[model samples]
Target: MVVKRLSALKRFLIGRPLKSNELGEQKLNKTKALAILSSDALSSVAYGPEQILIVLVTLSAAAFWYSIPIAVGVLVLLSALILSYRQIIFAYPHGGGAYVVSKENLGMNYGLVAGGSLLVDYILTVAVSVSAGTDAITSAFPSLHPYTVVIAIVFVLLITTLNLRGVTESASILAYPVYLFVLALFILIGVGIYNILTGHVSPELHTPVGTPVAGISLFLLLKAFASGSSALTGVEAISNAIPNFKDPAPNNASKTLMAMGTLLALLFTGIVFMAYYYGVAPQAKVTVVSQIAEQTFGRNFMYYFIQGTTALILILAANTGYSAFPLLAVNLAKDKFIPRMFTVRGDRLGYSNGIIILGVCSILLILVFKGQTEHLIPLYAVGVFIPFTLSQTGMIFKWVREKPSGWMPKLIINSIGALISLIVTIMFFLTKFAQVWPVLIFLPIIIYIFYRIKKHYLAVGDQLRLTTCEPAMPIEGNVIIVPVAGITHVVENSLNYAKSLNPHQVIAVYVPFERQEENDFEAKWMKWQPDVRLVTLYSPYRSIIQPLLKFVDTVQRKASESNYQVTVVIPQFIPKKGWHNILHNQSGLVIRTKLLYRRKVIVTTVPYHLTK
Candidate 1:
């Protein structure tokens, strides 16, 4: 049992022993997991419209107030989009995220592009959401502002460690927080709504800032759309996380999407309505939600409670990213579009390597934007929309390729869905290009590099293809070549061992350098093994690799001609300290690689463990 636990730990570090089943052992019914997924996306209500207001504030006074209508429009559009994805869930719910949809329909290349884009978006979701959450917390306690980035980072690290321990462990840990966030939103929004409906609604607006933006233009509307789309960011998380659901995965996934969609719409509507009721417009100077809280309860306990919840939810937002990115990485690896290491699971049976890489990237983003959601908002929407565009386009292709005659309902709905998503994607890119174009430019270069890597792996596989086996040949003679730098105990022990192998003959090959005062080693070898052969090759430029390689070739040619079995024993010293690895010794790999090409020759490393 102890050994099994130790082995499990080793595997966790390397990414094995998946914990999905462990989560199941707790028997979280489908409704529970669905609630977690729904709660994750639903929490965006705290900041989604605030993102829009940040951008629109750059325009006119009227544009500032336009956030209300825009938020309503976005909520409706997002609900429709969520409904569309329900079809996708039922159709391909074996964890076929956008990447799989795009790959199955469009092609592997596009799938990879979509996967990379979604990955970046999800990472941003975590960073931006958590940072925003931290902001909300700091608003409650102004003292924490200076350390907000540190707090955000700590949040990311905790989530990453939990995830690395296993998916089930992570889900179990996050379930209550997600539930608390949901319960908090319902209570707050519920009471806030009742207050609005009743004549008891009190007048509350922030201590007015400068005159708000007025007369918003088409471009301004587009920018608002881009920002508002952030609310829809984690909808795809459901697709990525479908695999984690209990059996009847598709039904569970569809129900989860529907539940999420309903809850998100209600939560966002409540928040938006309450913001308007309190006359809080989201501008760069005054984010709307903060104003609503200050108006509702002043700078007192209730205000602080909402602020604390915001911080908690934001920190938890990264949980959505943490869960999704690994699944996407798995999809990319399965397609042979990324490094094979991503395909492997770690000791906790989660993709720890991928998780860490994503966490680091997210932390960098949080720092770059100073944990400000407003600043990162522009870069945020482009990544999410890029994948949205590709996935919808792929679905169009999927519909076209299938050419289902009697399935006109499916065709018509998918076509409409595809057209709308594609147009939204393009609009977001056009509006957000200046703000986010650098990320767009950078991601493809990375995706292309991954493409090249896959190509190289395939090329090597093609080369190694075996056609026929060589007929067996009897060994006529045996030759041993012990590569020597200096006759240390390691070299002496290796030489002695090689001699004992009782080959047809033994020879010691040494590289002579001009600066070396190692004359004693050759003399010692000669004195000790007078009957053994010793060959020394001179390297004039002190270049060791070429001369040693040439001598080995010459010896191999002679051995092959005589049908000799040559065994080369290279003495290697394993350092006790890691830092000494480079300084103390080199050339172990170089020598081994060169000898690998020769046939009928066996190369062994007699490793000496260096003791402190």
Candidate 2:
């Protein structure tokens, strides 16, 4: 009844279990897909402009002048990426994303590099998005600043729990917030543009941020471009998730991808334009978006509403990672690069284990970084460009190798994408080495780990491979031996089962500790025995498994010499309550461990259920 109630509660919370056939029924339409997968791209407008300003402001207050130009570069880079991925959607509709493209075209090792890069980027997405979302909230309620880390962790847990219910469910739950955020931002951009044209913008904060960097170098602008590239974090999510869409999956997904890119391009352009128009810079107490929001909406209810939606969209943007990471993990596992457990779907037709892992990892990152969004952005920004370059280059190789109709145009676009992405990755790394060191160090370790996992799985497959031949006929002499501790109901039950095997011989072996214990046990066994042979072995070391193992080996060797079979029956007591297990020693477990690798011996366990 208790188990049933818990099941009921879980089903009520996460919904009833869906059959394997229902997986397709749970797919998203373009609208919800846009909402779920595109939130990161859209919500990025909230922070991308600010990251650029944060970098440029270090040189001089006049550095804000370069914000639009930096944003234009990022958008152009964004367009190249979108074009490259659009080709990927049609060619690899099954949805392995960069991992598939790289593995298939660049070779297994290179593919693993892409997989590792995406894995790191996905994890950092959750951490950075949750922290940024929490920052948005705390910006509105300054008193909540002290608990930002805790708040960020809670938000991660919430997102994980929601995603566990399945992708369509999470998309539905997240769609309204994404739409609200986009709507609010579009309105803000429209009003801010009018205000900018009319020269009615709000003045800068009375107490401005300190300008740290003295002069602007080529390196400085390049670093700012890399920083602003945070906007590109989730551009590949839809491409990675083509399988999650309804029928005509790839087409719907591609259309959705284009829609997302257009919206992101527009919203991002508008936000950066408005930021520069209002002369807003990153301040100590407030965010650039908030400053723009206050100026456009004038601290009215709409302003707070904008903040609310920004917080929601940021938290849900982590959904972009939650959606793609599991699918990529499953693909890697399918290729034998990772464990096969990730390939299994859960009760809700979701990759529940992957979702749980992503959540826990992000929470740890939040704790380690103390939920500081600015500190995490640099780490995540570098990870995005790795997969970006890999996927684009892989696609270029694809078009060149295939030479399908009109492939030349795609070839040119993707080549440009690959070069731009490579430059961005190298520039980002040089610009933020101190901040990106941990992720850089982590990447090689991840690649090594992937290789190790693949090696282990291959070895395991070799060991488990089956030979094709006729089965060995049953041996004339079949022997059954039960390891007896003493005469008890448990031993009697196991002995009876052994006898039921109808073996040519049934023998019970007892390992004696003390003389008196052995004598009493033997006498009791003789008196109570229905009909079974008894044997005894003396142990000087007081090791039960060692002597029993030797006795079983001897019987097996004797039987094999005469072409006979032997089975070792072990009696185990499974206590009803978990704590009750500690009351008894686990001798059966010890014996099984000793004989685990002994192919000559066969061990059978007879579990005696303990009700009390």
On lDDT, the leading prediction is 2
Candidate 2: where is the Cα deviation over 4 Å? Answer: 202-214, 463-477, 535-542, 582-584
User: For candidate 1, which ten residues in a row score worst on lDDT?
Assistant: 203-212
Model 2 C-alpha lDDT versus the unseen true structure: 0.86
* Residue lDDT tens for model 1, 334-414: 767777788776656567778888889989988887888766756776677667677766766776778666555666666
- Predicted structure 1, TM vs. truth: 0.86
Each model's TM-score?
0.86, 0.92
Per-candidate alpha-carbon RMSD to the true structure? 4.4, 3.2
* Candidate number achieving the greatest TM-score relative to the actual structure: 2
212-315 per-residue lDDT for model 2 (tens digits): 33576888888889889988889999989998999899999999999999999999999888887678879866888898898788888989999999999998
Residue ranges of candidate 1 with Cα displaced over 4 Å: 1-28, 199-214, 283-287, 367-370, 400-406, 467-478, 500-502, 512-519, 539-543, 557-567, 575-583, 587-603, 610-612
* RMSD, candidate 2, Å: 3.2
Tell how far residue 294 is off in model 2, in angstroms.
Answer: 3.1
